[model samples]
Target: MNSLTRWVRGPWTNPTASGLLIALAAIFSFTEGVNPFSDGHAEGAGALPAALIASDLLMVAAAVVAGTPILIKAVRALMTKMIAIDLLVSVAAIGAVVIGQYWEAAAVTFLFAIGHALEARTMKKTRSALAELVAVAPDVAVVMRDGKQVEIPAAGVEPDETVLVKNGAKVPVDGVVIGGTGALDESSITGESIPVEKGEGDEVFAGTISGGGFLQVRATGTGADTTLARIIHRVEEAQDAKAATQTFMEKFSAWYTPGIIVLALVAGLVTGDAVLALTLLVIGCPGALVVSIPVAIVAGIGRGAKDGILIKGGEYLETSARISAVALDKTGTLTEGKPYLTDVTVLDPALDRSDVLGWAARAEAGSEHPLARPIIDAAEAEGLPVHGLPERTEPVVGMGVIATLDGQRVSVGNLPLLTVEGIADDSGAATEVDRLAGLGRTPMVVTLDSRVIGVVAVADRIRSDAQEMIARLHDAGVQKVVMLTGDTQRVADAVAAQVGLDEVRAQLLPEDKLTMVAQLKADGYTVAMVGDGVNDAPALATADIGVAMGAAGTGVAIETADIALMQDDLLKLPQAVDLARRTVNVMRQNIAIALITVVLLLAGVFAGGVTMAIGMLVHEASVLLVIVNAMRLMRRNEDQHSAGPAPASDARELQTAGAGPLS
Candidate 1:
C-alpha cells in the first residue's frame, strides 16, 4: 500500500510528469474545438459529443496527476485546523473541475505543479554553497596506533591520539603538529586559495587538505568538537533562523490564505458568480510572499560562507550594512602581532653593536614578553651568545624586566624603569628613545651597573595590505577608521599615521578599550570592532559588530564573533562590509517585488480581466522572479568597488604628522 501511495504521488512531484500532462491536455482540447486560452468564455460554446469524450477523459487525468499533492497537503492542513496556500490551490482547481470548466481545471493544476517544481530547483541553487560544505566533510582518519598505521572512521579517533596526515589527504581532525612539516591548503576553512606552511606547534583544522609533505599531528579535537564542525553548525543555524521581516511575512501569509477563502465565499454569495470566486482563490496563493525573505537570506549567507566570511545571521547582516565607523586594535589587527628588532642605537660609541645587542638579548632571555621574541630572534640570527636563561628575573608590572646574569645586574625597559631604578640619563639615552619612538619602534633602555649602555628597539611591522584595507573601507562607505591600542601615545600615533587612521586612542587597558567602543555607540555611530578575539573580547562584545580575523583555527572566535573572517587578511574586512550591504539591498528589493506583484494581481482580479488559469500563471511567474533575483547574490563580483592605493603625498604627510607627536 505504501508503494502504491508513493507511485501515485510521484507524478505530482515531478516537473516532467506535469509537463507531459499539460501537453496531452492541450492536444485533446485543440482537437475537440475547446480553446484552453479562451479565459473561461467557452462555457457558451461547449457541447457534449461522442468523439469529444476522449478530450474530457484526458483533461480529468491531467487534473488528477497535477492536483494530487495539493489535495493531500490541503487535507493534512485541514486536519490540523490550518489554512495554507496548498489548501487554496486545491479548492480552486477542484471547484473549476466540478463547475465543468475542464480546460480551466487542467491548466490551473498543471501550472501550479510545474511552478512549485521550478521554485524548488532554483531554491536549491541558492543554497549550493552550504551543500558543498557538507559534501566535503571528512569521513576517514589515518591514525598511528600500536606503532602501526590504522584506518578508522573520523569520529572514532580519540583526543590526543597521533594522526598521520599524508600529501593531498584531507585532515580528519583538528590537531597540533608534533613532527615533520608541510603546507596545507586551508581554503575549505579559511577561504584562502594560497597554501599555508605548517610546522611543529602550528595548528591545523579538520577538513583542510595537506599540500605536499608528511606530518604527524596530535589530535586536539575530533568529530563534532573541531573548528570545522562549529563553523558548519553556526552556518546551519544562521540559515535556519528567521529575520524580522521574514517573521512578519509568515504571519501575514497565515492571515492571507484564510482571508482569501473568506473573500472568495463572500464574492460568490453576493455576486452569484462562481468563476470570480475561484479566480480570487487561485491568485491568492501567497506564493511569492512566503519565500521572498528566506530565499534572499539563504543566498546571501551562503555566499558569505563560500568566501570564508561567516555572518552570524540575517539580523547581523542587516546591522553590518549600516556600519559607519570601524574600530581596530593596533597590535594584532592593523600591525603584525609579532614585533621584530628594527633599530639598534649605540649610545656609547666605545661599545660595538654586538656588545649592545648581546646584553639586551641576555637580559630578555629569561623573559617571555611578545617584544622579547624579536630581540632574541635577532640575537640568535646574528650568532650572539645567548646561551642560557638568566639567574634571577623580576618583571616590573607596567615597565619592563630586570634580570641578574652571572651576578651582574642588567635592566632592560622603558624610561619609566630607568626613573624607578634612579638611573640618570646624562648619557643622552633619552634622545635615542624619542628618536626611535618617532619611527614607531618600542624603545627599551639597557642599563648595566646603574649606568645607561645602549638602546634596543622592537617594532611591530605594519602589514603590507593595511593601507589598502583602510582605503577600501572608506570606499565601502565607512565614515571613520580608528585605531585603539594599549601602546604608548607616541608609538600608537606613529603606527596610526602610517596606516591613515582618522582617530587614535593609545595607552588603553582592556577595560579602556571596552569603554571606547561603548562611547562610540553612545555617540550614535554604528561601530564595527576588529580584533584577534582573545584579549579584545570585552571591546568586541561592546561594539555594534565584532569581527574575528583568522578565526578558522579558533573555535571560540567562530562561535562568538558577529562576523568571523576565516583568514588573517585585512582585505576580507572590506569585502565583508560590501557583501553585507549588497545582501541587505537584495532582501529589500525582493520584498518590494513580492508585495508589488500581489497588489497588481489582486487589482487585476477585481477588474475582471484575470481568469483562474491566468492568475496561477502570473502568481507562479512572480515567485520565480523573486527566486531568480535572490540567486544574483550567489554570483561573485556583484560590487566591484575597491580602495585602489594610497597617494604618496598622503602617506608622506601622515608620516610627517605621526613623527611630530613622537618627537
Candidate 2:
C-alpha cells in the first residue's frame, strides 16, 4: 500500500505518464480502422455511433490527465502576479477544448509534458561533471592516535593529525607527508593522468588516490577546508552565476512573454478569430530565448572544472575570451623557482676546481642567501671537504658576499663586488663572467683576498614545456607573450631566446611589472598576467585577467585569481584560453538559434498554415535544440591534453566562420 501511494504521488504526478496515455488515445483516434475509439465531430452528437462517443471520451480523459499539471502551475504563477509560459500554455489548451478540438488539446499538452521531462533529465547531465568532483571527496579516514590506528569520518580528523594512507586508498586530507613513500594518482585534484611520487616533506591533497606504497600524512586541512571542497564550491557558485549576455536575455524574455500575450489579445479582438489568437499565444512562449545563455554557461564552466581549470564566474569566462596579450612572471611561471648550480670555472694556476668549490662552500656555510644552498649542494655532490664557516661574513645587496677566513679574506659574488672592494680582475675574469651570463647563469666571481680564483654559477631551470606553451598561445590567437624578470638582461634574453617569447623585460621590480601591464591595456590589448600571486599581485590586479598556477593548496589563489590551474602545468594555460574561446562561441551560437527560431515561428503563425497544436510542437522542439546545443560543451576536447597545439588552419576557419573568440 505504501509503495502504491508513493508511486501515485511520484512518477504518476510527473505528467510523463499522462503523455503516454495521451499517445495511446491519439493512436486510437487517428486511425479509426484499428482500436475501439473512432473519430467524429460534435455536430451530430445525437446520431453518433458508440465508436464516436467512446473516442471523444478517451481524448477528453487524456487531455485532463496531461493538462492538470499545467493548470496548477499556471494558478501558482498567477498568485505571485507573474505571467509565466505555463499560464499561456494552459489558456491555449483550454480554449482548444472549449471549441471541441479534443485532438488539438491532447496533442498540445502531451508534447509539452514529454518535452519538460526530457529537458529536466538532460539538464541534470550538464551539471554531472562538477558533481563528480564532489562525489570523490573522502568519506572515511584512518588516523594514528596514541599508538593505535583509529577509523573515523574524514571530517572528524583534526588538524595536525597523522593519517595513514595505504595502497588503493583515497587521501582524506590536505597535508604534508611525514613518513613512508607512495605513488598517488592525483588526477582528481590536478587532472594530470600520471601518478606522482610522494615522500617525506612532499605535499598531498584530499581526494587523490593512492596507487602504490603507504604514507603517513600530517593533516593541515580536512573536510570543508580541503582543496577538493574549495574546488567544488567554486564550480557550483560559477555555474549559478550569470553572464552579461544571460542577464540581458532574461530581461528581454521577461518583456517578450508579456508582449506576446498583449499581441494575442489584440489579434483576437481585431479579426474576431479566436483560434488564430490561441495559436499565437502558444508559439510565443519565449522558451528558447530564456534558456540560451544560462545553459551554455553552466555546461562550459562545469566542463572546465572537470579539467581542473577554475574560472571565478561567467563574467571571467567572458572576459578571458578577449585575451590578446599575456605576461608571465619569470621566476615561477616559466621556470622552476629553485636555483641549481650549473657551472664552475677555475682561473687560478695554484688551485683546481675542488679548491675553488671548497673555498666557496666554506665561505657560504651558515649563510641564508638563496643562492648559497645550490653552491653548497654542488660542492657536497662533488665529495669536497667543506669545514667551518668564515669567522666573519658580509653579504652585499645585489653584488655578492664578503667573508674573512683564517689570516685571509675570501669573497664570492659578481664582478661589481670585486670592483667595490678595489680588487682588480686582470686574468680575463670579466670575459669568463660574461661567458657564464651568456649561458643564462648568475655567475659569482670568488676571490681569495686580492687574487681572482674562480667563478661559480647557478640558474633556475627552464620548464620543459615553456616553448610549447609559447607556440600554443600563438595558436590560440594571443598576439604577444612577454616574459618579465628581475634577472639581468643577459640571463633574461637567454631564456627568452630558448622559449621563443615575443618580448622580454629584464631587471624589473614588482612595481615595474604593473606598469608594463597597464601599458598593454593602454595599447588596446586585453591582458592576462600569469604569476605566483605574491610579488606579482599588483601586476595581476592591473591586468584584464590574472591566472595562478599550482593553486590547489592556497585558498587566496583559488579565490582571487581569475583563472586558477589546480596543478603547476604549463599546458593548462593554453587549454584554458581555448576553452574560454570555445565557450563564448557556443554562447553566441545559441543566441542566434533562439532569435532565428522565434522569428521563423512568428512568421509561420501569421502565414495561416500553423495551428495551435503545430505551434506547440515547434515551440518544444526549439527549446530542446537550444539545450542540446549547449550540451556539446560538456564533451572533452581530446586534443586538449595532447602534446601538439591546435592547428593554425582551424583558427583561421573559425575566424572566417564568425564562430571564434568574441573580439
Candidate 3:
C-alpha cells in the first residue's frame, strides 16, 4: 500500500495522462481544419471561424490528455455526492454537448484545462526551491577507510566517517570539517547571501555548496536524516497540508446550475421562445466565477517565489490573510541561533579576559554541549593555549562546572551554581550579572577558590530585518503580535519589546506553547504560529495556521505547519499575508464582475434584445474579461516586498526618555 501511494504521488502521476490528451486534441483540431484552410480563401469569415474552432479544439484535447484523470476524478467524486458543487458544473457542460452545443462544450473544456495547467505549472515552479536542493546533493562521496580515500555512495557513508568535499559540490550531510579550509555557500540552509569561510571544526549542513579548496568533513547524518532531505520533506508537506479556499463559484455551482436551468424553462414557457432558453443556458455557465480564486492563488504563489519566499500552495496564501495573531519561536525564528561570544569578565584584576577563557576552554574541551563548542572556539580564535584539567572536575547538571586549573580550584556556571557552591556572594558580581541578563544575554560566571571572579556573556543576534517586518504586519491589519520563547523571562521581554510585539509568553516548554495556542484558539482568534523546527512542532500543529521557516525549520515543524516559508526570512511573513489579502480582494472583484455580466446578458436575452449568436459572443467575452482581470494577481507581486525603510531604532524611545534599565 505504501509503495503504491508513493508511486501515485511521484512526479509521473499526471505526465503521461497530460501527454495523451494533448496528442488527441492536436489530431482532432487538425481534422477540423484540413478541408477549409486548404481551399485558399484566407480572408473569408468561414476561414476565421473555422481556424478559431480548430485552435480551441486542439487546446481542449491537449488539456484533457494532460489533466483528464485528475479532472475526471474531481467530477466523479462530485457526482457521487463526495463533492456536490463541482459535479453540477460538470453535468451542465455535458448537458450543453448533449443538446448539440458542441462549440460551447468544447470552450468550457478547453478553459478548464488551461486553468488546471496553470495550477500545475505554479506547483512545479514553487517546488523548484526544494528541487534545487535535491539536485545539488552528492551522488558519490569520498570516504576515508584505513587512512585512504575510497569511493562510496552518499547513503552508505556512516556517522563520523570522514568525507572529502572539493570545490563546487554540496556538503553530503551535517558535519564538522576536520581538515583544510574553504568558503562555503550555505544560502540553501540559512538564506544568507554571503558565502562564509570555514576552518577545522566549523560545522556545515547538507546542500551547502563548497568553495575554493578541498576539505575533509566527518559525516554526522545521511539520507532522510540529512538536513537537506528534512528541509525538502518539510517544504513538500507544508504545501500539501494547506487546504484550499472554496471559491464563490465552486460553493454554489451545483445548485446554481439547476436554478439557471429552471429559470430558462420558466422563461421559455412564458415567452414561447426556445432560442431564449438556449441563450440563458449558454450565458449561465459561471466560468468566470470558477476561474477567479485559483488565478489569484497562482499569482500569489508565483510572486512569493520571486521574492525568495516559496508558499506551498493557494490554501496557505488564503489562510495567511485571516491571521489575527502570530506566535513566534525564539532560537532560530528571531535570533541568529548561532551563539557568539560578546564579553568575558575576570575575577582577579591580574587575570585578564584571555587568561580566564583559556582556563575555561581547557576544562570544557571534552564537553559535547553546544555552549561548550563556542567557548573552545573563542579560545582558539584568540590564540590562547589550553592545558589539560588538573586533579578533579565535576559537572553540575543544568548549571556550571567545577574543576582544578593550574593547581587552583576554578568554578564556571550560572549564578545559581555559584551561590549553591558558596562562591562570590558579592554586590559587584550581582550587579554585573543583572546588567548582562537585561540585554538578553546568557551570562556564565567564572570563580576561583570560591572568590568572585568575572563573567562571560554570549548571545544570539536578532535578524536585521525583524523590527521592520513586525511593523509591516501591523500596517497590513494584523491585530496583535505575540512572541513565545523558552528563554528566561527577561530575555523574552526584551526581544518582545524590540519586535513591537503586544505580548510575550516566556519560559514555555513545548507542551506549554501548545496549551497557550489552544487558549488563543478558544478565544476565536485566527492565530498563525511561525517556528524554526522541532521545538515548535506542538504549537505549530495546534495553531489555526502553522507557518514554518522551511530552510532552517525541522521536518516535524514543517510537516505540522500549514505554510512553509522557504527562505526562512521573518520578513516574508508580512509579505505573504498581504499577498493573500490582495488575492482574496481580486477574487471578490472578479466574482462581482462575472455576476453582473451574467445578469445583464440574461435580461437582454429574455427581452429579445439579443440574438443567440450575440448572447454567446457577449457571454464568452465576459468570461475572457474575468480571466484577464484575475491574471492581474500574477503581476501584483512586485508590491509585496515594498518595505518602507529600516527602523530608526527600537531603543530610541527608551534612550530619549532616560528610562532605567529593564530587569
Best by TM-score: 2
Show the lowest summed lDDT stretch of 10 residues, model 3: 652-661
Alpha carbon lDDT of each predicted model: 0.82, 0.81, 0.65
**How well does candidate 1 score on lDDT at residue 327?**
96
Regions of candidate 1 where Cα sits further than 4 Å from its true position: 1-14, 39-47, 75-82, 638-663
Which pairs of residues clash in candidate 3, taking residues 3 or more apart in a chain or in different chains? 17-65, 18-65, 18-66, 21-65, 22-62, 346-454, 347-453, 347-454, 400-413, 533-554
Write model 3 residue lDDT over 1-663, tens digit each, in one string. 699897676555455444444445445546655332122222245445554455445444443443355457657775676543233335434554455444444444444444444445545654455566668676778788998989887788899999888898777777888999989987776555578899998887787888788888988877678766766654455445423544435667766876877887787789876546666765676666665565555555555543445555666667777888887887777666777676687757788888778777776664544666677778989998865544677877777677776688776677777777786465376778788777776777777778766777666667667778788888888888887877778777767767677888887889999988888889888899887657777888788888877444344443445666756577778877887788778767877887898788778876667744355456556656666665565564555456543644534111100011121
Q: Tens digit of lDDT per residue, candidate 1, span 218-299?
A: 9999999998899889889888877777888888988989999999999999999998899888887888878888888888
The C-alpha TM-scores of every prediction are 0.91, 0.91, 0.70
lDDT of 1 at 518: 94
64-93 in candidate 2: lDDT tens per residue?
888788889889988987777777778888
Candidate 1: minimum summed lDDT over ten consecutive residues — where? 654-663
Ranking by lDDT: 1, 2, 3
**Over the full model, what C-alpha lDDT does candidate 3 score relative to the true structure?**
0.65
Task: Return the lDDT, model 1, position 383.
Answer: 97
Which RMSD does model 1 reach against the true structure?
3.9
